[model samples]
Target: MPAIAMETYQDHFDRPLQERSSLEPAWLLEHRKQAMTRFTTLGIPTTRNEEWRFTPIGPIAEAPFAPAVSVAQSVDQTVVSHVGFADMECIRLTFVDGRFVEDLSCLRPLHAGVITGSLGQALAAHPELLEQHLLASDWWHAHPFANLSAAMSVDGAFVYVPDGVTMDVPIVLLNVATAPGARVANYPRSLLVLGRSAAASVVECYVGTSYGADLTCALTDIHLGPNAQMDHYLVQRQSPTSFHVGALGASISRDGVFSSLSVQIGAAIARNDIYAHMGGENVECTLNGFYLVDGNRLIDSHTMLDHAYPHCNSHQVYKGILSEHGRGVFNGKIMVRQDAQKTDAKQTNQVLLLSDDAKINTKPQLEIFADDVKCTHGATVGQLDSDALFYLRARGIPLEDAESLLVHAFAADVTDRIRIPIVRQQIDETLLARLPSPQH
Candidate 1:
């Protein structure tokens, strides 16, 4: 089908305007309408499309629309405390389903002129600022999910750091999807803008409380000005029976540095897409990711790095450990334009299979048009080294423990890049907790 009839959502969209937040701007209504129009034009993706050839998204496209569609907002702090990450000194914004929970959020004193709060709130206070950065590319759409997310997003995190300011405290946006008895679909959104000479660290986490088959669709947009630097991380930890699809896009300017890592270890089916546009000179970008899947689960990742300027550098490394019929996919593409001379880029993808049924499909591609640019790509798929396993067994180590140790060490290549100590430890423990049973 070329389009999903508007009749599917017209009634819901025509509801009483008074039901929405009073602070909501009039422009937002039009913004959502445009997004819906684009979504209908794009329709749902299918396996025929090269981008989603291996994904086989029939489960998503054929599933009936989930009801009670309102974002769940009644989750109390007690439940959130148990969902995992230990309490630490930082700025945090909590969301249940897609609803923002103000009481659960804690804020610290930020530098002068720095603004960090709810996106719904920012729309009223700084509409001009949001309009400048939020989806500024007119006459453009990055597939249907991006449009669907824009159409359905209600409240999410918003951050803006002015020039010459530095934020020391890490910023965390915790999203928890809760559905006890029914299946629900939610879309979460975030926008971050950093000015020249600004630096900060941020985290986007998606967690589910129940084992129900919930669906989460998320999108994040980031922009960095000249000389700006930022460290970003995306972590997903939902029930193994749920589904997740998320996308992130970033733009960096001259002398800017953008570092991001993805740690995905949840859901039965998950697809992550990342795109980076380096259009300024002397820019540095790093993309690192780690995924652990087991028990019939699947994880897929697709990344695109485009270098449109000279004197830029990009590095990427992704590793996955799969077991128990679990499957994984990694497709990374790097492009260097003709004008992008003096560019240096490297990409690698590695997978460790713990069982005969576990499998991975990896593709690392490099498209270079610049004669002076240096770009390389590689991918490897292998099981645990018998030499290493035998060495551990020779020391009287239990077979299962030896296997677990090797798996943990295999993950260090990507996990070691995490700068936050607490988050590092959290991922480390979670990795061990989810280790698969030995196939004796």
Candidate 2:
């Protein structure tokens, strides 16, 4: 396929919604129309936009990415196992090219009253429920991609836990893109809701093979009721020549607890925009991120934590390791509302540049309106400590081995926050595999 002309951003992304809306509910069609309108109104953000100043998206804006709506092929078990955790006890839901593949999924028995399946199925079975939550968050209008997901995405994982329920097993939302001749694009949307006092853990994973440059636009929403608790993890391991843009919106009620660990170790040009809203008082939130890039790849992570209520606590730690001509960006903003007294928030962004050409642009911000809040943010960009490197080499470690050890140690602060053993092990294995590869 030839490259499309560089026209309006909407020209490159104008998907046909009318063709696929016959089976969908009327309300959903209206929702998609509204979302499409919103997306066109917002358009593609440019370098002039402060939030997108560092990440240049010309490849995504101008390239012709075909809508992969009807691919008949399905991946076998071998390909599935190669992308995610090897041995794990969990209820896994799989999607290929943004559509669910039930044959490749393992839907285990979950707790009573719990709902787990693709968003498209849930829309038919529980339309009212889906109406209440799908693309209904306050942050969906923040960027064009968020509304784009709502308008264009056909299927994704949906999990719902009722009040007082506790799910011991994990729920995995696995999405994969194929290496087609044409540069195809997929919009994957996920939603997870936990009722009052409910508890659950979710793993969101994205991966793809080498390609002519596939594009993936993923959006996720999380809503936690009062006293609810959740452990969340996001792992991105797409191919090196792919383009990925992901957006996540979360809201936690009073006394709710939400903890997430994000691992970004893939894609040639990737961007993540995450927002968390504290809805009530005494909420606990933690956001940790780790990214490793090499071979002229670029990864950008932007986060916004809104402390809207009083007595809330948030801790953010983001670390990046860039090599070769790789470039990375981190922009984390913590906002404490006027009534958010005693809001304890601390954020840190640190980077390790492995090559002279590697570059990082980090901005850690704290916008506090309350007088009684304790907020702090800091960012550091540097290379490995020469003294530490020398000491490791003196202890009989090879130069490459010493650097690898330090790199792992540098990323442990974020990876260790993941409580799931399988998730942690997968990350460790990926790190080891990347150590010997010339490209990451």
Candidate 3:
């Protein structure tokens, strides 16, 4: 494939980083320039790239790119109301068109040394931590989107939890795009560092107005110190005409526990890249994801799990449901390093298609350089069971209702793994509403 012309998209790419230079560090500026150079050399990924073989970026690259501009329009409360998660009381940080809205947010006072605020505020208040953790990690290789996010991100959230502080209440980061016919782009960056023995749960939600052609490029970096525990969930529900791309990098220390759940149900094109590194012994990690697509929508998930230390365990399971002309992609890779003895890793990917036009491509890969490791990977793609459908019909259940029940049942297997009640309920309701009627 030919390289995409940089002249066509240079205007959209240059404006955001230029306007935010006053706030960004000088070192970061140099890094961004280097990243932009790499982006220019690599251009947009195509079907030929091994990592992106099943997904295509031609449509996104062809679309005229535009930077999100400031607007005075208030966020639609109806859209906000649609974002609640059962009984969970949260500190809601709201962003409209890549800028923070202080008045619209509901932030709870912290009891200790933890700091949770806008990225701009953090840059001024906690420059030391930001200097150490902000885009300084080594996980930013070969990922064009991550590089773009670091170079052009204007606004995002920053979270810091001090040592021994446990936050029981989930912190909610809500990002919404309010303009119609505007090609909006956002880089919602989050830096979460859990000190030794600290614990917390976080929920990140990406939503947009009902009628907008938007784009969101988000990045989250989580660092877990020794004996720390953290649970994270990302729920993406953007406009059907929007595009969403995200990347998550997590590092776990000795005796740390990290769990992540991702649910994607919106956007015309969506892609997610998740990377987990077990850097210490006795660490454990779990990665789970579910995606539902309809119409001409496309969703892709690419994940990597690295066991760099000994006596660690990791598990990953991803499921997808496609209907109409929808398409889905899943790629999971697990690597056990040479010195990482006694490592246990498991991975699985499953898909269910409801129409002949629907398509799914799934790949699960495992690479082990350790002599004493247990690893497994499996992938499956198929449709609903005809015998089960006939059995339900024979039992006098309406076809549509039976189909809904079965679809729900299939998705429930993954949703049940969610540890948070409020988040679990929200996933259930969202899946129930977005799923197609079983009447077909």
Q: Which ten residues in a row have the lowest lDDT in candidate 2?
A: 1-10
Per-residue lDDT for 277-298 in model 1, tens only? 8969999999999998898888
Question: What number of clashing residue pairs does each candidate have, in the order they appear?
Answer: 0, 0, 0
Q: How many collisions between residues are there in candidate 1?
A: 0
- Model 2 error, position 156 (Å): 0.9
On residues 1-440, what C-alpha lDDT tens digit does candidate 2 reach at each position? 12233233345344454565667877878877787778767777778888889999888776556667655374667667896554678889989889999888888887888999999899889888989987468687868888877877879888999999999889888888885656778999999999999999999999985565888999899999999999989999999889999999899999999998899999989999889999999999999999998988999999999999999999999999988899999999999999999999999999988888888999999898999988889998988888998999999999887877888888887888888888888898888778432222
Better of 2 and 3 by lDDT: 2
Name the lDDT of candidate 2: 0.86
Sort all candidates by lDDT, best to worst.
2, 1, 3
Off by over 4 Å in 2: 1-16, 19-21, 436-440
Model 3: per-residue Cα lDDT at residue 116: 83
lDDT scores for all predictions?
A: 0.83, 0.86, 0.82
Error of 3 at 355 (Å): 0.8
So what's the TM-score on candidate 3? 0.94
lDDT of 3 by residue, 20-48 (tens): 67767887677768777776767678788
